[model samples]
Target: MTSTPEPWGPVEPLEPALSVRRVLTLERVLAGEPEVVAGAAQLDRPVRWVHVAEAADVGVMLTGGEMVLTTGVLLAGDENAQAEYIRSLHRAEAAAVVLGLGRAFPTTPDVMRRAAERCGLPMVVLHRPFPFAELTEEVQSRLVRRKFAAVSLSEAVRTALTGLITAGAPLQRLLDEIAHHTGCPVVVTNLAHRVLATAGERPAVDDVLRDWERIARQAGGSEGDGWIRAELGGRGERWGQIMLCGYRGDTAGGRLLADRAAEALVLHRMLGGTSAHTWEEQSAQSLLTDLVSGVVPARQLLPRARAAGLPVNRRTFVPLVVRDGDPAQLERMLRLLGLPGLVAEFAEGAVAVLLSLARDQDADALAAHFATRLRTESGESRTVVAAADPRIVWDDVPTGLREAQHVADAVADSSAALDLPAVVRLRDVHLRGLIRLLRDDPHVQSFAERELDGLLCAGAGDDLLAVLRTYLASGRNKSRTAQLHHVSRPALYRRLEAIEARLGVDLDDFEQAASVHIALLAHDAQQA
Candidate 1:
């Protein structure tokens, strides 16, 4: 499948947060160092950066990197308070605390001094007054210098790689060297988009696929179409993402820069991983290659299969396809699948579901029941078609995927012709292909138009589908259905009667129920 299109914008490279080593310290400032503020303590500084405040609890509220200025107004009123405040500052990991020479205490409180010494936190006392703005300007200038250096370094690396490529140099050594220098996992994706090399612990493919779409979108179509774009923690499990805790000194540029570097590394390898293969450019074609070449080898498959928590040595795989639209509905279905032994991947607007081997001959029934349960939970009028085949080990995955595709396609095509409600499935068809199409056509569209025209015209198609889907979920239990919809049973009955009357189908009759069910599946397919 094609990656999601990235949002359009002018390409801006991101950079990492300023290193603690780059900041100046209070001691350095007092010593007449032109750059006075600790780099870790300075924020938004073009000169030396300092903060002077008496807020007692500034420690927890702080994000380090500041030459903390305090008038000692909040000095510990008690021995405990003094120690606690100092401890909190230490925990906040501030670069240094600079106390004004004159404050609430006659001298540096013994307790405060002890606390700072115990915590190994830096403490400074200003003997002379200095303008806060001037200090800030100096610190900011140093930060700008650091950023410029980083940019220059990044450009140098880029140019070196480009030159190497132009000279047809081997990339493996270059990647290893880069990984060593960066100290981050280095992954090179092949021209076919399969990961060809990696320098860190590997993560599962399913986990990677989860964020791949978002990464693709952010990179944008044209922005990273042929070139590289970077982002942070937006894709996969390893090198994926992590909570920043708080915004702190993290600038948007820094976050972007880290991720872009990752993207660049991946793209560079993807472009250079193999001999230029014109055919591998297509995602679909690459998918075929990954399947045929056993990119996810049988040896790796078992670990992942076990990770998925599938039964060992069990055979048979069923592929289930999820229809698109309605994110809420998609979310509900996804929630039911936190268990292992099931592998799912999103292709286009649909999610492909893989079911491991079943226990017995009732595999199809089990699969159907599992699917039906998911449908009920989602309360969506979407199609879930399953293509089942006898249990095959991972070595036989290529055949399974191809077969599943055929089954899903068949179900999708056949269901379109039915006069069903909002949901459809492959097994819903008693016959295959054209015959199934004829059976569902009227109920699929015409019948739905007749019965649901009000909702359709009111642009309440979603609401109508939800209601219909929920009705099925409740097993047509009017009381339970009423409670879910917050409507009385009488009202629900009336609606059901209206639906039956409009469609000329009686719910009580088996033939009508079967017909309506088929029709619903067909309607959903056509919409899909």
Candidate 2:
């Protein structure tokens, strides 16, 4: 059976001392409100009469918006205590003070006015006796209204979320809606710590994720899942954090709401492809892609990075190709380095590092340590290479990437023969020799076309072509190809038909196609 929603709680009555007008006045206050002491400036502003037992102890008793009412009995003998009392009231953000015209404070002293004026605390006096009962009733009405307003706001949130769900809203749209309703900037990051959606001063919060990583770690871990509320500035000061815990309320109602929102966001992301990426792997792959003509420099990308606070100087730097098992593994290795001045792009299943090394000796040590750490983590028996200091300009990442990939490829290819981990430099390899061989062999060019050209030409749907290349490369063995492609035996046969139709090649007749494959490889070698 479905349970009914919880009804709004009954409104609580305000304190008898305060009047309705005064509590209402607080809602309009921003900064620098006037200070009126005693009944001198009755017409100046609205006042709430918050009675205090001890005039001297008003500071501790004053919260954000109370107007202190006292008989001044505590200021009987000490001027310093009197001055301190007024100052405390001001500092505690009291709306105003009312001095009852009787007892020890029968007359408003000049010191009281000066202190109140100096500290900016308003002072008021009741000209004639007023009933506390009538004041309390009025104040209670205002309090009830305010409570209802809060409930209305909560209901609005529910309505907005329902509208979004019905309208099939995107994550970005949802975040924008939430920010609009909350009257605060909002940022939503995925489990992988990448910002998914943001509203309100997004550009200002570009470095938020990076900075928040440390904050999150201190909170617990990078994947810390909870709503954290903290005051923005000082204690009880302006801009304080009003975070909800556990992505919801610390306890009941808010918790369920926040949890539901989080789940909806997750589902939205799954449909929208806003999933967090594995940085290290993505970085390496991007670097390699840039080098191997896998991707072109996009104008849209760097602007997005800048918006996220990754201020890439894009001037003089070295492109360090950092390879490891994965992003988590690379992060661990980086921490183990125990050195400073290292920033990395963890993208495309690879780690492309940028290091600011003052000492040449330190550079060498960084490379060696990174390589050793990589080997330990990779477990793939691969030797990862860290590039030599190459002057990489913003536009030159592609060229630098090419150099990085060439060096790494040479290392990887040589690993088996040399029984050494591959960490070769591109310039160190005999590019001229490879080029000359390709130039002399015309058949190699044709072979590459017959074998690999179709893979590139298929546009986005090239997986079938890819299977064909691997199948052919493995010497036409169905079992080996099936294992490499991660397909069942029957699926392998189906993939072969798709591949053959797309490539227009007869894989069954390998003898005739061998010549064409050789020619295409020759062309690639020349380009290398």
Candidate 3:
């Protein structure tokens, strides 16, 4: 990850809208001797606006979520009119209705009270004469201020995230910015619901991810508690979503934060590079790379693995490295095998896979099975599958990965002419592997050139070198070498004579053949 200086100051979060209950508790509104007459439980409804109306059909002139202030002068005489007025307010989805006392009626109307109770609409009655203008002014001013604050908060978050994006922050840092602003758990996921990145305060993130699958499934719909999501990507190319769970602030504010975070993430990914793989794969690649680097401890990554749907406890861990293989194909193969693990592209033409084995499973057999499956499926000639020893815990996975990677790299560097086994281990390429590991040593190069100098100075074509390789591979049998190369016995004899004349050595001697074979191996390793 690239680190850049913070370009913006901290942003203060916005206050949520004042609820009907909060409005009732205001000093000005409370001074009106307001008393809840019905639907006390509905007082928490958000009051978007405060309207003062004294008419029979005020509901028609008003929109929803308004706290209506009116005297009952329009319904003073008719009981049906009073009930209809309350029903109309309920139908309009009004937050609450405040009926000013004195003049409309000396006491609260029973018809309106019964109607409000039946419809579950909050009904408030002022015990004394109260100025509707004063109450409306106070509530409207507060509502406008809240709206301004929300807009300001949106701008602040957008600015902060844009600055971070410009600074080249990664996906996790963008999510961290959202979590910091919202004081909640933030999660980024692909279309497949795989967790890409998560950020928040510590234990809260843990609690949110403990049963991550269930929570994520529930999050698909908008039924969970304060789990707000903003879609990522645009122009008909939706890729993922950003979710905030257990946000303490208003849903609107949380949504603002999520939207801003989503925008920043989309821009960051676009600016970096384009790939066919989704962000989920990128997330897996980043995690695997981090594990391989060993800069962060394995224990710290356990939570992330678990959150990504890996079973981390009381299981066997099998680390595999494949050279010249496709990681996306490997991931599909794992799913087809009903295995739970992670697959990631480690480097060009190489992939890394972490498989979770059962306690009763045989590690060697499973590794061989995986290697055979890959060979059969991919049909790539030079595929190398290297497996590390099984680990029983998550913390030991990094060690296993390092071992597998080393083996894979060694095998990749080995001579391509050698007949490699379907599944390669460190022992398979023992001596040649050591030479390749030390290929950079000046002494090794000098030895190899000195050993093969006679044949090299002859200016011979590759045919003689091919003959030498086949002869050594055939265990120094002239008949087998001739048969393998499709040449007559006398022709093979002539080639062998020419080779000995050039190198001044007997092909039939064991010590001489061994030295030349070792030299050839060193030469191939150096070229590789």
Candidate 4:
């Protein structure tokens, strides 16, 4: 039942003082020889305040969570009034009722006892006369101290988190601090319930993620257990929430931790500027980069991948790279295609996508579909999608990612042969692939510089270079090269003759043309 809030004091997210069980243990209250009459199961309910009232209708004045101390002096003989009094107190949501027995019909009354037991309200009876003033003073002072302590906790957490942020600490360090304060697994997730970042003990966190689907489903709304979430957003745009999984504390303190943690996170993002990616994107980028770099063993990352909500058990992993693709748009495309994948921009102008598929699914078909849909959605018909053979084991993923990147780099060569497929692979790149791999070698660089020096040093270096690239890419067909360059065959022959004179090599010789083409390809790859 909703009641009017107290207006005189602080309405912190966490309030309320001691529980009924704790209150019973107080020396002042125990001096009265208090005995549990009924409703013992609810003794743990929080007692926000102490109210001493003899009026039968005192429940109307309550704002809930009050520990009411009544003597029953107003109703000595009326059974109906006694019963209705307990019923009214229960309706008021009082934490518990302490009855002084001397003036209120001696021993426990059946009517009041039965009513409190029915409503599950803790009912206590004092055998000796107890000073209501003393109990009220002790509980209220303690409640005030608790409120002050709560304020202190809030400031402490805020100050610590702020200090970390000011020191330019990373997101993981901030989350770790929050986890240390709460002593629970902390999870930050997107609106789609995908875990973006996590901190806490590894075993406990893994336990929380083991049944993540159901837990994510239940992430919405306030739950009775230790789960508390604080919505994370600013400027009226809520993108996600921060959760305290299985936090062991009062509701108010738990919420304070969550809200403070969330505020620190939002501030971290805001201060990080535009390059500050969403936690999920950053997480994926870190994971995939590590996988491709092979700095960390794949087994160590398996748990992190799983905790991040990616399927990694006995699944087929496909590695793909898109040249100059938008990571955000690619991620959206992955979702739209109903495929399970992680997309991140691991390198400048190069975005990597890792797809986890079931063994029964056709990896090739899905990959093709992804490529086709990406082109259509992006409206870049010539955009290249490079992929490697699907890997079944997690350990082989790094090799697959490297291979896919290699394929992507190979096809990025502008001087490569024409008519490349929509999705370029290792086999499709062929000889150009080898040249790309060797583009960085000193011998290859020297060879390319030596072979291309004639045209490169000429006045119309770029113009003639384009002509030569087209001529060689067309497999030495002068007619096609002239058409592609929008020049008549006579003009093209004159340029080709000049090229042969400058380079001192015949363009018609198969081996010479092939060597020149390979050199040009290497130069282009290096430049790219």
Which numbered prediction scores highest in lDDT against the true structure?
A: 4
- Backbone clash total, candidate 3: 0
Flag the better candidate by TM-score, 1 or 3. 3
TM-score of 4: 0.76
In candidate 4, list every pair of residues with a backbone clash.
14-252
Query: In order, what lDDT does every prediction score?
Result: 0.49, 0.49, 0.81, 0.86
| Candidate 2 per-residue lDDT over residues 396-425, each given as its tens digit | 555555556445444433312343434445
Q: List the candidate numbers ranked by lDDT, top first.
A: 4, 3, 2, 1
After superposition, the stretches of candidate 1 with alpha carbons farther than 4 Å from their true spots are: 1-21, 24-48, 52-65, 69-95, 98-112, 118-120, 124-137, 143-316, 319-353, 357-388, 403-528
Top-scoring candidate (TM-score): 3
lDDT of 1 at 430: 47
Candidate 4 per-residue lDDT over residues 1-528, each given as its tens digit: 333222112323454448999999999999999999999999999888999988989889999999999888897799999888998989999999999988556888888999999999999999988999999999989999888888888887787787777677788888887887787999888888888888899789878877677888888766668899998889999888889999877877898889989999999888876222467888899889989889988877786687676898889999999999999999899889888988989987789999999999999999999999998998998788999999999999998898888888887765544577778888888888878767889999999999989988989878888888889887788899999888999999999988888777898998898888888898898898
TM-score of each: 0.34, 0.46, 0.77, 0.76
True lDDT of residue 372, candidate 2:
70
> How does candidate 3 score on lDDT?
0.81
Model 1 has an lDDT value of 0.49
lDDT of 3 by residue, 180-276 (tens): 7777898887777667878888678767777677877776676346888988887789887888888877777777777777787778878877432
